[model samples]
Target chain A: MMNYGIIPISHLQLAMSIILVLMAGLVSAFLKLGLLKSLIWGTIRAFIQLSLIGYLLAYIFQINHFILILLIMLLMCYIAAREATRRVNVPTQEPLLVSFLSLTASSLLVSVIVVTLIITPRPWYSAQIWIPIFGMILGNSMNGISLALDRMYNEVRSHTAEIEALLCFGASPWEAVKNSVRKALRAGMTPTINSLMVVGLVTLPGMMTGQILAGADPREAVRYQFVVMVMITASAALGCLLLIGISYRKMFTEDLALTEDMRQSHN
Target chain B: MEVFFQFTQITHQFAPNGPFIHASGSLQPGKALAVQGPSGAGKSTLLRILARLIKPTSGTVIYQDQNWQAIPPRYWRRKIHYLPQKPVMFEGTVRDNLKLPFELDLLGKEGSLDLDKAKLLLTEVGLPLASLDHDARTLSGGEAARVALVRSLLIDPEILLLDEPTAFLDTETGKKVLMYLANWLQNKKNRGLLLVSHKENNLAFFPGMQAVVIQSEGTRG
Candidate 1:
């Protein structure tokens, strides 16, 4: 029973999810929240949501529905955007909108392109393959955009004069921000890069390890990780590009000077 | 050819709920305008307004015969630079910071000084030519202030706004910085300075440079 694959993975995930919700409830209790209510409410929500998602995924795998796969892809992006919005510093909220747009457009484009053109999954829009793969891609892209937005905003704020001075002198807004932009992009992508480097050597990634334990051949597991990692990297890159380009306007004026709202929000 | 900047009835209040910190004042260009006041006075605010770093609550800043409102701010910003009470040290080398004022797009299009002129300006301020090759973060306070001043002037802006540039310097260093500025203003015959300082001796350093004691407005004590 311990060695069994899907059962162990599901049990572990359930336990971990329960523990996290419990911890959140406990923390909320100390903060004078309705602790018992949240604990019960949160556990139920997670169980239902995950159970429904699990059945839905099974249905998707059997049906191989393209429309359903696209919908799921979009849903993942929407959730990712929501998560990212909770973390950024733009007070007026255009930055949040840009983040959402970037996450949706970039992750979708990259996932579709890579999955279709490169991986060439049989049936092309196969839901079983697309949903899980898109999930990883969109999730990481969300993290990337969130981190990049936070960094770019902070950098622009603290170095306001310098950035303006650069713009005044002749640097295009993009050129003026090339340093910060590159740094933001690098910051957003670094974690994924580091995790990819250590994945098989340090610890098997959840998906690959799950598949291997579920009796898939080691070679097959490696192939899937290879495809997933490439997809994730592509998604992260596209996400950063979209975020920087689209959100660049919010940080600067039409003249491309850094704005006061961006500068003073932290204070 | 004419005045570099003109401030007309410019006022700024830092706190929306607080009393007006800066009453309106009209200042002409090509003349030294000294902003002297108590700590809470808006000397810094006024200077920032001239630099267009901070917009005034009311009134206008005219530069090069056109009102500041009409000009593209980035275009005006190219010609305007403010030295804060504490100038920020941008990351990287000393050469990096000194080279900054030149990096403005305006300088690139209209024209900018070569390295030799920059070195001369640095030397006049008593900063070593070797400073141009080192990191900015390592510099002492007085040294950084001197560097900030030199860099601001390097852009050749018609109007200059300085806030407590000499605060961190000793008597000798402060005088040297002031004297260099006075000489530069005289040499250029047009570029004016709005300096905010408390040092009485510093006032004497630029005789031809006009002075205004803001606290002199009221408060007999």
Candidate 2:
């Protein structure tokens, strides 16, 4: 059987990619974009997690088990929910669980539809294709959820007076939370929008980079990246929309107030 | 008249060596506390604890004979709005700032957004009705501070705990805000106000007003 792992050249590229990511992180730390410890911990966690994921994928590819693939994707999504709540100042379990449920459900359906009806890959559980694509989409959703939650919590605390005004005037907690939720959704989706706005013009995206590196035709790579971009957009939109639109009511009480301790819950 | 607000046995240390470490005092409600300490003396923290924004290390704060913690913080916060020493205004129109807590979510709702309420608050805070549409970021320090205060008052809490709310305002603006607050609190319908200020203003403005000096020791951030 042919090798499923990357070529030697790809190994070199991966090493360089890791180094560059670390460097970029260090620079941001120096610039105080946020806490330095956060970057350090994030890098360490990402490295260990991704490495384990790499080994797991290799094993998953050999088995070709649909149940295993489904199970792994669910696990990845569970971790993603934890990530979404990591930096938030709100109670994470409910929202994080909600976000994870939506991300997994939507991404699974979309990926299944795309791969089966559209892409038509042989052996539907082909780890090579479904895994990478799901990784990108679910990862995007994680970041989107993270930003949305942080923004939502902050907006609530900062605008207490305005919130109270609404509550006093007979606005339900949902009614009170409406503005903050919208702002959070907007804030979370901003990076996606900007990337979409400047894609191809600003930078070649990750998918395109991978395709080009794989020695695919430039046109083929562009097409793949285009499809992937649309998928990502759909994924991110669906994740945010479902979580923001549908699940928030369960997070808070009928009075529009947070149902539980909305604090960061000690990291 | 004397300060009615009281903070008995209030002991707070934000951090081991941080400034504003030690503070203990009492101010009769509806009275002003002129925190005249060099740099920091736990004045803000004291105010924060009273407002239920921060909890004290160990102490009892009797707000009408009710343990501050026993009451829901939101209820206390609703009645006792905390205005920090520095005013932080959000990014939006003056009207947006006034309606900020609801604008985003109430988009499709019926009759929740009230323009009239916003204008009346602006006027109450001494801003013209036209200022409602003014950009929040473009407002001067004095204007922002006033808007911030009005925003806090929007909740209609029964107690006002200001932390150096007038530190950024011009003397004229500061005087006006102080006067308005004094007059508002004097009305039996209004809640008691515990204003934190350092400027030289006549203490006799409020009938039941007295100043509690925050003694600054080495314990301050």
| Candidate 2 residue runs with Cα over 4 Å from true position | A1-62, A70-129, A136-227, A238-267, B1-6, B16-36, B91-96, B99-136, B150-155, B165-173, B213-217
Q: Tell me the whole-model lDDT of each prediction, alpha carbons only.
A: 0.73, 0.67
Q: What TM-score do all the candidates reach, one by one?
A: 0.83, 0.60
TM-score of candidate 1 to 2 decimals: 0.83
* Interface alpha-carbon RMSD, every candidate: 3.5, 7.4
DockQ of each: 0.29, 0.06
lDDT per residue, candidate 1, A61-176, as tens digits? 99887787777777777778888878675677476678778988877787788778877878888886677777888888888888888898877777776665465444567767
Model 1 root-mean-square deviation? 5.2
- For TM-score, the strongest prediction is 1
How many pairs in model 1 have backbone atoms within 3 A of each other, for residues 3 or more apart or on separate chains, i.e. clashes? Answer: 7
- lDDT by residue (B1-221, candidate 2, tens digit) is 34344577666655556433445556554455554555556666567667654556667776666666566654555566667665666667876666654443322233233677666767766788877778888888878888888876665556777767667777676667777778767665536776666655644466756566665446532
Candidate 1 residue-wise lDDT, B105-194, digit = tens: 556566655778888988888889989877888899888888777777777766667788789998887888888877776776556778
Candidate 2's DockQ: 0.06
- As a whole number from 0 to 100, the lDDT of residue B211 in candidate 1 is 58
